[model samples]
Target: MSTHPHAPQSHVHDTLVVGGGPGGLTAAIYLRRFTRDVALVDKGNSRLRLIPVSHNYPGFPEGVPGTTLLGNLTAQLERYGGTVTHGEILGLRIEDGVFVADCLPEGAPDDARREIRAHTVLLATGVADAGLPIEMWREAIAFGSVRLCPVCDGFDVMDKHIAVATSEVNPVGHALFMRTFSAEVTLFERMSPTALTDDDRRRLAAAGVRLVDSPLLSVTLDASMKPVLHTEDGQEHGADVFYPMLGENARSGLAAKLGAETAQCEEIVVDVHGATSVPGLYAIGDVTVGLNQIAVATGQAARAATHIHNRLPPALRTASTRPPSPGTTM
Candidate 1:
């Protein structure tokens, strides 16, 4: 938090990272190498927040949990003397030549509302919850039953009967990934399914996956339908676990409103340097077009940080050790 005339505007930040998750945090570290005036603002709930232990994060031989990894990242960024603020950026608008981020102290426990005017802004706020229709989905999530990101939660379902509900829209993708665990695997297509090619049938058969093309009757914990998926077709199938890879929204409305071209798939559009179509605004991590793993997010952050730094004008650049000014509270 910095101060100035309006809200006690602080020293001009070389880069303002609008998400403290993987991409934003990584960007802060890289930005600090060139200029210490970078700030990372996040609402505090990362996409990986629900993740338990992540084996694919790289570097951790035993694999670290998502929260622990975030803690380590925060510690590393703070060590670089970068400003990491917990706040929710409610609105993003470009004022004059600077990007002005309007956020309340949502992520911070302290009651402080402020804005950051930076030479450049990175939109790492990421995506949102794509709508999903499921019985007991929310309750199970709150009770630590149903989970997101199979890579993060599949291990817990090992040796359990797993039900993968892929709407007619997306089929055949998760079969390979979810098969890492769950000995009894069932794939359910709610609508009429497209014909699976020989390769599709072969790979699935190799993995001991049963294919079911039927409309879902219901998913209940205590129903006689219990673990079994009682389809309208008068068939009984059991499932100790269920995974839905239906849809997800990449918190990209801000970038889209800014007029950046978006891909039709599940992510945002960005150049090799992680710069979005909008100049001075970049994106990275799960929200960006790359591997959604932590290592990839960390790498993307590092790359975007350097890219933004090199693009900065000489006047905006500061000494590597320069400390951020204290926040001017509102």
Candidate 2:
């Protein structure tokens, strides 16, 4: 809904936002409210769209569907005359003190690419979860049988039978976290059990988390629409909800290409204002090393937009506007 399919290719914007997730859209809104020329480009793969419903996000007593929330934000941006360009940015570089983004617009040919230029750039590209090997896993997610974030939806599964599946060498952490929400928690190690240390076993046991070391062969839904796990050892385990703790892949390649600092997990490192190591470039949301929540993303967007506005040259005004002294308010 935020997309402008026929956006001009040559106009340079004040700030170009990459990603159409909550953070990117929020930033575009703020920049537009500040009267700055802003352009947003989205590849249409935001993880927020995968959320069935969110109860943790404030102001939604009855909860809101993910798609509905995204649509609301897009609509808000449009009210401010801000539009998003549907495209996949293939490359980014600095040319004459401006950032240039080479993008493949949606439905364009492989050889066809467009260049978008901006004085500053913000990357709100979110992460992709390492999904389960089950067919129709997304359908299970929509049915509330498979969840992604424990911090976000653990309360919804309180006192319910929950299964945490992971291929990590040590899988006790998430299992223990799940124990706080439910009495019956199972940790399914989808890899060799020998990788787990004795400390991991003791911790899991102390937390009363059942450790099932058998490799996960497949996952299916029972007649009750609950997730039933099939182990390689010819065993079946049923649970009210399934959580894949396999981890995630951050979409920070664009920032990395500009020599931005990143963590071992490839999450972009940013300052308090969301500015990356590369000057005039910023990152927010799950792509940055921080809490992956909608509230956090919007807050980061606000801070980044304010900082960017202050950094850019001020527009013409009749009266001289200057920053107030420290400990003083204008």
Candidate 3:
């Protein structure tokens, strides 16, 4: 929330991190600690902000709210003299061996655009879930009735009646995965049964997951604030928790515009160090092809920051921290 002014046009940072999520903030911290000039731009739409509470992230035994975690990361970055500009990057391109980002400041006039220059750019823009059919989906998530990642919150819904609803014809994987946490698990297909082969049906039956061919008409909260699914056949089913397995859309447009290779799903393709196919460009977190978890994103940020630091020229050192010559006395 630090309202620092944006860097002047002539000020080209050593690295420019796009997005203000955990991954981007962590990288800014690392790069600043290395004494490298860093700039970060965020549109303020990270998916982490929607998570009510996370029990999977390590070191927090009591669990932490997503907003609290994000706030802490932002504070830590500011403490290290790093600032995040509130803007949407309209386009990214390389010019004269440097990255130029065309950005639209948040709430600015449509024609008022500015360009940010940097030697290297890190795209930490995360993905967005398709979400549920409920109008108050975010409120449902806060109420712990509508879950997103089963891998992240499955333990919390243990022994509860779980419902997995997907538009895909065969979404047995998520239903089966939820079955591991609860004995009463059901899979509701929102599409007409066409691609659901007999083998798929057999697997669900073997796993004790009830398969519902009727599409979910709507989902409403019951008296207890639990999700109650109304199917096409006028049958209503209530569950302790509901998961919409529609899919996710990765925010890799900026990287794609820079000629960076991306997966079929539009996730940025990255190397072991999180470097993209384009030189001086890198991507990490849900934007990249990997597990979309906060822990994984933070770890990827560390790798990319270290690699960028080593690849760039050594930062200027002050006399106090300068190394002594072999024959020189301290």
Candidate 4:
């Protein structure tokens, strides 16, 4: 973790990026390359930190751990004079033509608050998924006994027994979606009141997806280290991978606070350039609507940074190497 305390003054930045995950780090690199003064504030709870391995990302045939990938991105950004500061952004507001945010520094004194002012702000705050119901959840994921994000790891579970569990009111759609990847798919509708609607039953029958009305009891590794799901009815279902269909909670509170439009899922609505309804306020990565993946985040970051760079006036076009000193307001 990193910390920076403000000396009772506002620090002006060309762009202030929130969330130090893939999107924010990539945006920092791009902005620094464009000679813009950019700062990334991260609370260090990135979903990427939980990934044991990613098999779909390009340039890594052998697969790469999430932490490793994040480190690589951080190094790349630092090489270009961009760095991530660990802080929790407590408030965000726009005044004049600049965005101002208040932050609490990590590992610093309780009274050491920091204020950041920027011409532009990018919210790359990612989302979090409800993990599987297992005591050794992290170990299970590391051993491929549990998995999430069918879009990212569906290939690994193809043609294998897949168990999906979700807490959504309507878990049928997620169950049906997983059927495309494997025929041996079982959906555990544990939290749904009306677990299956007429349409849901019809679709599940058509897709050959087995429906388990019983709630999950426990999950543990079997002899071969495979995930074994035990149900309330004392029935045990063994699978190659136990996938949780639990929906993700997007970290879009700041965006909503700024009156930005968001989808029902709380994902920020953004244009192709990652600009939200508010000018100079942008969003990217899992925080925005689209495929929630690292590659997608980096692309959105690139586009947003470029758009911000091009939108600046000639006088402010040059990259800002130094941040505003204490007491300096934008």
Candidate 5:
């Protein structure tokens, strides 16, 4: 582990990526390839870590397991001389044109914290599912029986039994959207004051969607590992897949702490190149209010890195033969 005592010269990085998800890793790889010193700090709790298999992640016709994909990304980053650290960032601040970050190691002592200083910072903390009310939830996702992003995997459930689960005040739209992929669709309005207006009910009826107001009793897998949604009333709904439309909590505190502007859904607002309102501060991936997809994240990372590289002085610019800085720890 690299320990920084807030030394005047040590522990300084050209770029500090605050998440180990696809976005952060991609940025680290690009920045390192640009011959810039970069460090990635992550605690392994990204939303991507929960995906059992992503069939739409491109280049994988059969699909890729989340862990396997992360492993490959890490290997590639290390090969490019990017440092990976396992820690949770607690706070961020700007001082004298430098960004300072405090990170807490996963299992270290409470008092054992490290501070990292960076010329630039990339916020890729992503978002977390707001709430999921299901037993064996992780297993359900692993079996592809429960999904979160409809745009990413909606085609997989085409013409199959599907359910839309939402705890929002109104789930009519989500339920209707799911109906586009399957005729046998059910809306599970669980514990939400969610009600359908007469017009909403008529639309659902027209779309052949069944709306149920009962709260979910449980979600379990049978012998064949198929998902089964049980309701409080003794009604059982078996579906090939279910969508959780609960919501997402964007992990943009690091950006907000630096006084960056936020758009709808509290997502960190960034320019097309992923630069935040605060210069040298950038955000990408689900932390921004966009089409939260892996491909989009990687693209944002590449653009951000290129922009950052252009801002460097000609002498400081990285070169193919330039070795990494020695004082900074990975």
Candidate 6:
């Protein structure tokens, strides 16, 4: 937790990056190399463990998992020269020439919070899965069954029986991607197919996707940790792989509250430099409108770091010198 309350934060350093996913870590890496005093705060992205392997990312011909990618990025950040604080940012604001943030550690913080007054702030708050939490969902996750964003984990479903549980008429590109892995793909839309357009219907039909238009009532986990979803229309379906093609609301509430432009899913509209509507508050990753992937997030953060470094105020901005002392002349 960090912030700057009163006078301009001349000592709070160069930047404070929030959310240590791909984006935040990349931002820190670039900022540290440029000699900026940057700190990273993460709420521990839980989705890391679920991504079995990711092939879309370049440099890894065999592909890598979300957890492994994040771990390597963390090491790079620490090695290059960035401090990491495990916490959640509660508040943020901009002063004369610095950005201020108020935060506290996880669990309980009776205001054990600290203030980080810096020259810039990069908000890489990625997205959280948007859905009604069914009790059995947790059980499904542990057994590596119910997958989110199949594009990120669908490869593991090769030659296996898989079902898509969602509320979209066609579930868009998901049914297509899943079909490549498992021919036994069952597309379950918790709604009526009539809600879909003629083109949507044609595309799905051409794709040979089986559509199940029924409301999902509940999820029952079997002994093997497989999910047996009971539909409201009294249909029972089971699959070796349960893919929730359901959509999600981005983690942009904080940015929105600060007057950053937002749209559906709270995806903030950020420029190429990660600059938002506000001057000091910036964004990266799926929380913004650009492509939502590990590589996209990492690239956006790197570019944001370069942009922020170039825009730092003269006071908080530092060169290759020792940290300025309290009474030291500027």
Best by TM-score: 3
- Residue range 1-330, candidate 2, lDDT tens digits: 112424476567788899999999999999888878887999999988989899998899999888998899999999988888888999999998889988899999979898888889999999977756775788988999988889999999999999998645336777888888999999888876446778989998988989888888789998877999999889999999998875888999988989999995689999999999999999999999988999999999999999999999884456656578899977
Please identify which of the two predictions, 2 or 4, would achieve the higher TM-score against the true structure: 2
- Model 6: clashing residue pairs? 1-103, 2-101, 2-114, 2-115, 2-116, 3-115, 3-116
Poorest stretch of ten by lDDT in candidate 4? 1-10
Worst 10 residues of 2 by lDDT: 1-10
TM-scores of the models, in the given order?
A: 0.77, 0.92, 0.93, 0.88, 0.88, 0.83
User: What are the lDDT scores of the predictions, listed in order?
Assistant: 0.70, 0.87, 0.87, 0.83, 0.81, 0.74
lDDT of 6 by residue, 1-330 (tens): 222222243567677788888788888889888767777778886355556667778899898877898889878877875656778888887777567777777775556776767767788888887674444786577567877766666776698888876444345467777778877777766654435556766777887877776766666777888878777789888878777766776888778877999976789988879899987788998889866778888888888888888887543543546668898987
Query: How big is the RMSD of model 2?
Result: 5.2
lDDT of 1 by residue, 1-330 (tens): 331212345456667787888778888877776644676777776866666566666678787767887888889877767656666777677877787767677544444657777778787776676555556665555444455667656776778777886644446667667878866878876654445667877887888888886766665554532344567688766666667665666777767777777885446799988888888888888787655666777788888888787788753634446455798543
lDDT of 5 by residue, 2-31 (tens): 222234445677778889999899988888
Per-model C-alpha RMSD: 6.5, 5.2, 3.8, 6.4, 5.1, 5.8
Residue 151 lDDT in candidate 6: 62
Error of 6 at 27 (Å): 0.9
Superposition error at 314 for model 2 (Å) = 1.1
lDDT of 4 by residue, 209-245 (tens): 9988888867888878898888888998888888876
Model 3 worst lDDT window (10 residues): 1-10
Which residues of candidate 1, in runs, are more than 4 Å off? 1-7, 107-113, 133-147, 150-160, 167-169, 176-183, 192-208, 222-236, 314-330
CA shift of 70, model 6, Å: 2.7
Q: Tell me the lDDT of candidate 2.
A: 0.87
Writing each residue's lDDT as its tens digit, candidate 3 over 1-330 gives 122326787678899899999999999999988878898889999988888889999999999999999899999988878888898989888888988888889999979998888899999999876755785888988989988899999999999999998545346788988888999999887776545678888998999999888887789998788988989899998889999875887999988877889985688999999999999999999999988899999999999999999999888665675579899986
What is candidate 6's TM-score against the reference? 0.83
Task: Evaluate model 4: give its lDDT.
Answer: 0.83
| Model 3 TM | 0.93
TM-score, candidate number 4: 0.88
